[model samples]
Target chain A: MNAPPMLEARGITRLLGEPPVQVQALKGVTLSLQPGELTLLMGPSGSGKTTLLSIFGCILAPTEGELKIAGKSTKGMTAEQLAELRRSSIGFIFQAYNLFPTLTAEENVMLALDVRRKAVTNPRQTAREALINVGLGHRLKSYPSKLSGGERQRVSIARSLIGDPSIILADEPTAALDGVNGKAVMELLSKISLDTSRSVFVVTHDSRILPFADRIVRIEDGNIVSDVRQKRA
Target chain B: MVYTLALRNFIHDRISLIVTLVGIVFSVVLMAIQIGLYYGSQQVITGMIDHSNAQLWITPIGAQSFDDSAFLKGGEKYAALSRPGVASATDVAVNIMAWKRADGGQQAVVLVGTDSDDKSLMAWNLIEGSVADMYKPNAVIADKAYLADLQVKGVGESGEVNGRKAVIVAITDHIRSFTTLPYLFTTLSRAREFMQLGPNQSGFVIVRVKPDASVAAVRADLQKNLRDVDVLTNEEFRDRSVHHWLFATGAGAALIAGAVLGLIVGVVVVAQTLYASTKDHLNEFATLRALGASAGYIHRVILVQAVLSAIIGYLIGMAEAFAVNWATRDTQLVMLITPGLALALFLITLTMCIFSAIAAIVKVTRIDPAMVFSR
Candidate 1:
């Protein structure tokens, strides 16, 4: 009871497009994500999965409903405050493996540390340690262009883990990876959640990942049709 | 850190950076050359008036420049000496006449007539020979620059001026007039006789003021005392001499037009180059913004980059100007590139770069981070 859920969404709703032709992207979705939880959000294409992920990641705000992190409601928060919250409390792993090409793999992760406003001494060393945790210790100095697709995603994961945030939100991280590398990346995320108590929220359309999640929420056309934690068998 | 980023970014666009540097080099070199020639021409025009030993000149009514010839009916020497501020006064006679050269050619000269006794003001800047020889009846002084044109054999050489035998008694430095013509200094009696007039004819009444006297007060008193006569300080005369030479034709207009054209070309080149570079890097800047860099941070990077480029380019350009100056030190075309002139050019170049950089920034700031994901 002393450790509250790291992420909570209460009746979250959002609309896209201008008035008179508004398209509802999310319809009053509610969820609580505790530390050590590995959750998967599965939906067909155009089912508002990405919209829900962006709202939870603080990159986009919901038009209605309260979103809270560590029991603090994110109401009337300024843009700077949201950025600060993202920097301090949440880590994001994009599907594109958005590593700046000009920087080395280690420096790519170190940039996350820089944006987090942390007073880390020797960011390269910290970045190397994070990479080693994700099994990319030897590829620290390689540029993003030099790394393979799997290694690039590992670097992205290292970048997200560099800030040691309470929750990690990943959007389609495995969509670009092949089966073997994708499975490897998913295993890494599960290990991070169990070993470090960092709640991991992943949005994916791949059914292969459903077995790996502690809970699975299924969405169709923008509404959650089923929320199940485990197989009945 | 932002400086480091800007430098790296600049290095990335090596070709653009080189083009920008070349533009600045051309601008700075042109500005230096233009300013040097402008000031050099001014010096040439005002050199004689600046070096003259006279404190003031008194001419006929409303004449501010020496070209406005005035006639005094008498040897106003005593009349000027009687003034309260006058230290000494002498009658001067000036005439324009042709002198025979050794080459059998005739060169026009301003024949300046001064008293042989007033050696202090008679060919005072003697580069060669002696000013004291003016005591000789038909002796004349010429400027060293006109030595080849006059084709005089040597000192004591004779030449015919106004149908009278004139000896090359001495050569003086900086005796050339604003018209780029040579002046021949002669004794007052000879000049008066050569340029025939009534017995009382005098071209100007020179006046000298005491060190303790106020120049303004002196000028006012003299203008009042000598009714219908013009009186001016030495500085005013120098200004008028320069102005007269500058405005005589359309030369000043041409020089000014050239400078203005150079400025326009420089601003356009820098602005266009930077703007193009910005457009090419729109994606890169959007990526940086998406990575949490603030607008202010991006602006700092651009501004610092422009300043660095300006400084490097200006220094290289100034070095080129100095090379030109050193190459032409002995030539008549004075390439006087002063530090003040170089500094002014640098400031102007920097301002143009800043304006151009701001233009680039305006285009850059309009790029939204969403563009990185979409386009």
Candidate 2:
């Protein structure tokens, strides 16, 4: 049998907010993430794309149904176990460029390795490599506040990629950048997705990111409307 | 990385860090001064006993301390001197007497008289003149600090003790009384004359144990011979005096209560300051959580921040405390900051900061990592 998908969500449902008026964020959503593919979950505002991404990242527990990372069932897993899964197998980038403002670019990237119990032998060297790969080698000592919008986003990407996890989750990765910077980030993401051992999952409503996607899945009203395979243009 | 995260976060908000450190420094200085006052007061209370060479003392029954002892009617000194283990014994008279200053102002003075020539229970730290000079009529040795109270300038000044003519024969320095009264040192004959008593009357008696004799045995023998007086070792008498002044009254307990209050305030202020600092970074902590940093890891980061605050605050506070000690060195309210006290204060400071970190940690743990994805 082929190896199991990097992440899987089957009949996943999620409830948010307090009872009496709690909103159903996801209603029986089913999805699977495969290695070597850049998949996009597209939807408008208030759609459950971010919620689904959170589930895939192991940051939230589904109200119902089975979720798994690397073929292992996430059902009944504790929060700590889910964190361990995310730490070891998954990386995340946010649209707002969640590079810790206090840390230099290299230190922000090293934080990923620091969170791991046992990973890279040489953290500084590995962090430099990750930043260099994301085209931030010259700005290694710069803090997030000192970097431009695009540079800060690159630092976040470097931080996400430092631990060498099997999966990358980007939440509206280019939503806050200008056109040239946005196009540059998308190109970098597309290039990173080419590594066969890694799967890239992005959640966004921006149509500008569609051409870089290897597969596109659209969601509306907390439900998937379509899933299609496409060749990257 | 934990230290890195902690230190960076600790210094990120300079205002909050200063508030936290100020709380810690205030706590340390307050506690150090209060405890130091207690030790200083104890030193003053027991200075006479500590300076004595006598192994044992014979005091009147029901005497609480040296200053409160009733005069022995007769024969306690002879009884102690007649004991087999006792080599020599001398009468020591201690009483609060009326002092008529040269300026016509009256003040209460503690008159201490010891006739032991081997320097037992005698006035120390003499700046001028000899103890032998106290034999000239009503001559006495006085401390320079008490010159204002006695209305005297230096040696050769004259004052009156209990309506009798008294002359300053020697001058000493830093010999202070816990009661803030002046101490006047004189010979036993002069003390008897000043207090209007006959030669045989005294308040306490000092006994010297022979070189080969056990002090406990000599004390037991003295107690066996003395009928109406209580025989005690010098150490036992000093402890009694200290306990009587320190615990039997509200003075020492007040100092302890103040120290405890300082500690409580320190913890609360630090806790509030740290909680505020942590709240300032709650978003980043949530981001760390969502990025797969463990709850334990985040907790460690906050605790490490508290440790840093504690160490820095403790050093600054100790420096301030030492300065306070130095400032009060020659004053009436002296502070004695020993090494042990400094170490204890450092440990207490750490506890306070760590205690403060718990409040910050609670807020951090309650944060939902999913919040990072929302905005």
Candidate 3:
């Protein structure tokens, strides 16, 4: 039997803003992100790409429809419950490399377990191991301000990988990097997906990284325009 | 790691953090000084009553404060002594007298006179001579703080009180009263002679209750028997005196109002700085939320930061306040920071900072975690 999709959204609709000025950012968008696949959500500004990513990341709840993670429905869950599920089943990567400048790379990665509210045994070792997996073993003690953009992004990726969640949601992960750095980051992400059987959903407009994605989904005006599977470089 | 992050954020930027710390310290010190000044003023206003060991006091009827009293009816001590709970009763005299300065200037002085053997009311902190020296002929004790006002350089300098010949036999320090006038200490009879009152006349009577007697019962007996005088326990008299000079008079009202205003201003200042410091890290807070941090976790982080700031700020602030208190110990502006007051200030600071974190909390809770996706 085929395994269920790691992250799936059905008829996801979201309204932004207040009455008389509300924005229908998403309308009946359905997508399934599978294990061992790097899926890219591509669209222009105001095209509901981030909104869809936010709903999938459990950061925002849809106005209608359901989000299922590992075949478990996320309907009627409180914000805190959604947060718990987000920590346990999903990982997030921001475009700005949102590592706390005050915290060193290792501490930033360990923050994942801190949010879990569960007693983690030797979390430092776990965080160190994750950073090592991301090729940042030598930069464990470096703060975000002390590291370059690529290194900071890598630290962020390490932070997302800390809990080994089934789904990883990345928003413009390579938007701030140069060609060489972006290529290296995409190659690393592609390798992570192929090696770990974890679903990696990337929301980006950077077409340069398209060669590394297993599938490409294009969106416009809050609707999916095209979706195609591709071969990696 | 949470505490480490909080502390790191607190100490991250030396200049801005120093500025914030300076603001916190300034608010704390301001509040301490204001409160201390009010407390010191109240203490000075009731110094005689507080220092006295008398179990009960007999002042003329309608006496508002120790400084504001009429002469007691004659035979007050005898009436008090005849009371059932009375152990011993002694007459005392208190009146503001004119001091003939050696500078050919005139200064008003409050002369407090009890028995030379009276331990109830006596000169304290005598730096130059013993209290026994108060028994010497024409001898009186004067505080060195007002030595210049008394127009004398030091002890043994002769001065005149109400045109009577008196000599300073001892020097004291910080023996000031509410009226901001110098106090001269001498024997009760000597003071009576200086004032030229009748032989049996005294301003008030100091009564001590028997060891087996309850002060309240003794006070009731003395009040019932002494018909022309108001009998009160020492604590009652001290409180009455403090109430009169602390909240009754115009100066007293002004001082209390000033202290309260200072405290409010201090709260605003500390709150603003604390809120600004929290707001300074909004981006990081949003980032944490985007990283799947729970609301409670974010709350803990912010509150931890506030608590850290409050504790550090309170310590440094109180240290500065104590330094100022010590610096002004010999001066007229005495700052009293009791242990109770210190604890209160600490709790107030901590509570204010924690409340200040609420603004940041509300903002962070409403932040769109998806902003991390946008430019």
Candidate 4:
């Protein structure tokens, strides 16, 4: 008997807009994530990959779906309950490196721990450690506006990892980076997934970082076209 | 952390935060000045009553207010004194008389006349000279606040009142009337001479109650004993005088309207500035929401920002108001900011800021965390 997946979605469908112009963003999409694996969700623009990621992050409710976190059914969870679940179990990284411009790198990372009301002996020290792990120790006192795009994204990645969450969701994490910085961020994500034994789900259309993924799922329109497992080189 | 974030955000956006603070400052100062003027006017209206040591006042029948009293026979003072519990009674002759300035220019003055020997009924505060100086023939006490309007130097300056040479023997502080008319305090006989009235004429009778006597009881006794005259406690006369000037004259309504207009302007400016600030930071707030921050947390952040603006702006505005008050200290329209008024205005500033933050709070509450994921 294998352990249940850390996160699972079954037959998820999302309809957006009003009656006369409703658009189905996701249709019966099914996905599962296990610990210690980096899963890449690849799709073109408007292909529902981001929509599925939003559902996995607990920010958007699926019209029809059965979602589970740590094998607990989220079938009828309220918005507040979903928010609590997200705070405790998931971490989100945006492509735009959505760090508060006013907050220093360490402060930005500390926000995740503060929001969850996690009892850490020293939040600043914990945030410092997280930033140092992401190679942002030297930039801990710098604000997002003072950092490069890669540094800002690393700060965000540090924020996502600070809580030691069960799952990490990254939406186009490397979309704003150049080839070198993009590769560095992808490798860092892969290493974090293996080192922390946390599931990493990344939504990206960039193919240059495909070698770092343990599994790849491709979506088109509103459905997943393929799912494949690959041996990391 | 919410406060910390709010402070950091405000400090980070220097230009916008300064603009918002400036708006708040303008509102606070406007309200303080307008409200200060209203209080100053009120003080002026009740100045004479407030300074007098009389426990009760006897005016002619049908007199509507202290300032509008009809002349009574000078013997009314003896009738008031004969009442039980009445310690002493003195005739007070109040009339509007023309004061001839040194340059021969005449100004209308509110002349207050009482027995010079009655020390208890003298001006409450004096800046120079003593009440004994008023015993001199044709001597008067003037308020320093009206020296410029009266065109006099100080104590010892000479002027003519109703064609009689009158010398300013003393100067008092803040003894102004609601009409902004100069006040002239002198002996009863001198005032009657200045107004060209008969020696037996008096406008009002001021009475003092014994130490062990109840003022209300003394007032009732005087009311029952005095015929064809209205006997009222000092407080009643003061309130009646204030009400007559504040309501019947339309000055109070105008002052209140100015204060209310200041409040409205402050609220609007604060609301607009705070709303614009929230709009500028909408994306960051959305990101916070996406990171599992509840609506309450974001609301607190914005409210903290507004409260900070209010506190700092209030300090600046109060400083400016004090400066204005100091500059206009010598003028008849004094700007008076009492401690109670200051505390009330502080609360008003806080309320104004919180009220202004509501629009921003609503905007932040409606922010969709899903937008963070959108392109």
Candidate 5:
């Protein structure tokens, strides 16, 4: 019972422009993501996967629909409320590895703690441990420019997990990596979700991530064409 | 925490930050030095007046217009001394003349004559030599700053004023007219002798007010008693002197206007540099917005960055101004800097940064997070 569903988006519809020339980015998205689940959103280009991901992450407001995070209705929520929810309940890993370039790997992880307004009694030690979890313990002082693609992605993952958010939203998190690094990142995400009972959602066109997910949600032209669940071994 | 992030961003922008700093530094330095010079000039004009400690100065109307040739008839002081509010009145003479040197050269000097035993005004403090010896024939006190100009390195050096032999008895601190002439203090008779005026001729009338005397009443009495003359307080005389010098031909005002124009140029350079830097990092800001930073956070970051750059620039500018002041300290360029001037510059630079930040904030706040999701 403790591993209950944590995030739910029901009948979400988001339009892009004004009436006559309106383009629907998300026709209707309905999905239940439970704790300890790894969901991969797979679709072709322009499938509205990124749009749906942004909405799930509490960043983009849907033109019309309902969203509930931890069973709380997201409707009528103020900007501050959304920011707090994003800080406490949702973690983000961008495809670009949008880490603050000025900060080192350790500091980047600490930024999450700082943003959440958490009192970091020992920032150095906490950051070291987070980097250690991502196998970047040795690169604590290395800046983002000095890190490799895989290392950078790992740092981004560490940043997301540092806040201990209930849900992790990764938008093509492994798209920038090669096969070996990409598979390693996917495995690390799967392990994190399983170990922490945190729901992980990956928006990607890369089919290689499908095997690592507990469920696969396929989208085509702004609509969820299919939802496939694969039993964990 | 947000400030830390904004500061880091500002540092990362090396070229733009440097450019902005250069602009701010130049503005601050110029503002401090130019304003300081104005203050120094004001002090120079009023320093002796303030130190004179006279309750009143009576002269002809537009007497300051003839400041270079101010002289009151010796008989006028007698009439002034008879006024009810007047405790004492003394005759003084002021004249601009050249002290001819033995080396076939001339030193520009302004002759000031005061009584050796004065109960009224104490014009220039004696830095060297005896004040009582000022009334001695051929004895005069020269401004300390003019020692080198007179080529008479020390006190007791003999010189000729208007072809009459004179000895430099005392050397006071730097006190000069707007024309930068060395002020030479002597007795009324000696000054009259040098200016070829009769013993009865005097330039200004110095009066001491009695303890219970009213200045306005005395001034009105003097104006009524004397025809075609002006009676002014020491402070009023100094103010008139400054106004005359500043607005006579509009040269000083024009120069100050030029400085103000330079400040505007600095503002424009800083504003444009900030705008370009913000534009270069537009997407980065959008990414931050998508990352759950509130619009207020984004605005604050931009303002913090701009202000940080402004402060760095201001400090650099002040440093440059100090260097300029040091280099030109011995010269007549008179580059000066003061705390109030620096404070004013800081406020100006802060305002410029705020203006620059407004543009950046507007740009960042309007950006939708959806832009980050695109490509």
Candidate 6:
């Protein structure tokens, strides 16, 4: 029998704005994400791709429907509970490479571990190991301001991976980078998804990096238009 | 690590941090100077009672304060000395008189008359000349703070005091009065001569207890034996004097109002600066929240920043206040900052910063994690 999906969203709908201007950002969107799969969410600007990613990451509560992470239903959870769940089960990467400008590369990664409030026997060692995995060992002590765009994003990726969460969510992870650096980041995400205990979700409209996705789901007007699986090259 | 985040953020934005620190420093200095002036004035109000070596005071009935004591009849000193536990008793006469300056103007002076034989009950901080100088006929000791006001060159300068020819034989330091009257020390006989009063009359009687005697017991004995008069311990008289100047006359209320105004201004400035800083960094805080940081954690970061600002600002302010105090040490307007006052001001600065940080904290706590997504 197959393993349970790492993330599952069923008939989730989200409404935005007040009366007289109410808009639906997502509607009856059902999706399942398996471990060791690199899934890409692609759509136009107002197609609710970002909103769907937010719901999947637990950053926003669904207006109606059930969502589960690691087989636990996230229905009726408080904001604080949802935050705690995110800390333990999800890692997020943004397109801006949002590393704290004042913190060093290693320190940025250590912040993730610190937020988890887990018993970290040697945080410095863990941070250094994460940075090394992202090929930033030589730049461990460099601040984001002193780093190149690619280096900063690597630090951000190191930050996301430091917590060893079950799923990684990347929102336009390569939109700010040049083609060479963007492909490099996508390759890294692909490698991370190959680990059977982990899953990667990328939300982007950039079709140039489509070859890296193991599964591509297209969204339009608050609905899922297509879901396709492609064999890895 | 959380504190490190706060420290780093503070250091990263050096310009804004320094600006906020300036606001805090301004507040601290303003409060310190105002409060210090209030304390200095209080000190001056009880200066005579505080400096006297006597353990008890005997005054006319209904004597409300040291400066406003009613005259005691002749032989009151001897009567006090005859009581048990009263080892020594001396006459003291305190009367506000006029000193005729060389410029043909008169300045109000607080004339303090003590027994000629008991020098210890007189001005103890003589900076120029000795207490023996007051024993000379028509001799009076004036505070150095009144050199320009009284228009006297120095010791040995002759002036008219209360319409009597008197020589300023000694100059004492810090013998000031809260009423802005310069203190003039003299022998009881000379004071009587200056005031043109009967030889036996005095304003109060200073009583000293024996080394082994309990001052409280001595005070009670004196109170009982002295009919139609009030007997008070030294501390009681000092408090009475301070209370009269502080609350009874409304001077204390005015000074306190000034200090409180300074505090309010400081809090407002600090609150505005910190709120602006937090608003500038709202995006970063939201990002942290999206990354699973708890509200409690973010609150700690802001509090740490405020406390750090308070500490730095307090140090700079204290240094500035001390410099001002030192620069004005010899002036009529006394600025006194005691260690206790310094500590209290430091706590006030911390409280001010914390109060100011509340505005920032509220803004931070309201930041939605969804903000990071839109950005």
**Number of the predicted model whose DockQ against the real structure is largest:** 2
Kindly report which residue pairs in candidate 4 clash with one another. Answer: none
Ranking by TM-score: 4, 3, 2, 6, 5, 1
Candidate 4 residues B226-287, lDDT tens each? 78888888788877877788878887788788778777877887788788889988988888
- What is the Cα-based lDDT of residue A2 in candidate 6? 84
lDDT of 4 by residue, A66-171 (tens): 8898888877887668778887888889999888887889999888788877899999999999999999889989988899988988998999987888999999
**Per-residue lDDT tens digits of candidate 3, residues B258-284?**
656645654565566656766777777
DockQ: the better of candidates 5 and 6 = 6
Per-residue lDDT of A145-168 in model 2, one digit per residue for the tens? 999999988888888887788999
On TM-score, who's better, 1 or 2?
Answer: 2
- Candidate 2 per-residue lDDT over residues B210-314, each given as its tens digit: 899999999888788789988989889989998898899988999999899989989998899888988888878988898888999999999998899889988
Top lDDT prediction, candidate number: 2
Task: Kindly list the per-residue Cα lDDT of model 5 for residues A1-233, writing each as its tens digit.
Answer: 26657898989999878989999999878887888889889999888888899889887888888999998888999876887788778888888888778888888888777776667688768878999998998999999999999999999999888868889999898889999999999989999889555899999988877789889889999999999889754
Q: Put the candidates in lDDT order, highest first.
A: 2, 6, 4, 3, 5, 1
Best by TM-score: 4
Using DockQ as the measure, name the better of candidate 2 and candidate 6. Answer: 2
Off by over 4 Å in 6: B61-64, B78-88, B102-105, B208-229
Which of the two, 2 or 3, has more lDDT? 2
Q: Which 10-residue span in candidate 2 chain B carries the lowest summed lDDT?
A: B327-336
- Which 10-residue window of candidate 3 chain A scores lowest in summed lDDT? A111-120
Angstrom error at residue A191, model 6: 1.3
Residue A13, model 1: lDDT of: 89
> RMSD (Cα, Å) of candidate 6?
2.7
* Clashing residue pairs found in predicted model 2: none
**Order of candidate numbers by DockQ, starting with the best:** 2, 4, 3, 6, 5, 1
**TM-score of candidate 5 relative to the true fold:** 0.91
- Candidate 5 at A140: error in angstroms? 1.1
Give the alpha carbon lDDT tens digit for every residue of B1-375 in model 1.
456556766666788888888887787777777777676677766555555577887777655455445567674666667778788777778767788887778988778887667642467668678877877768888877777767875577777887778888888765555555568888888888878855556777677788888777877888787766678777877777666656656565566666666677677777777788767767656655555555666677788778877898889988998998888654445556777787888898899788778898998777665454331
DockQ score, prediction 1: 0.22
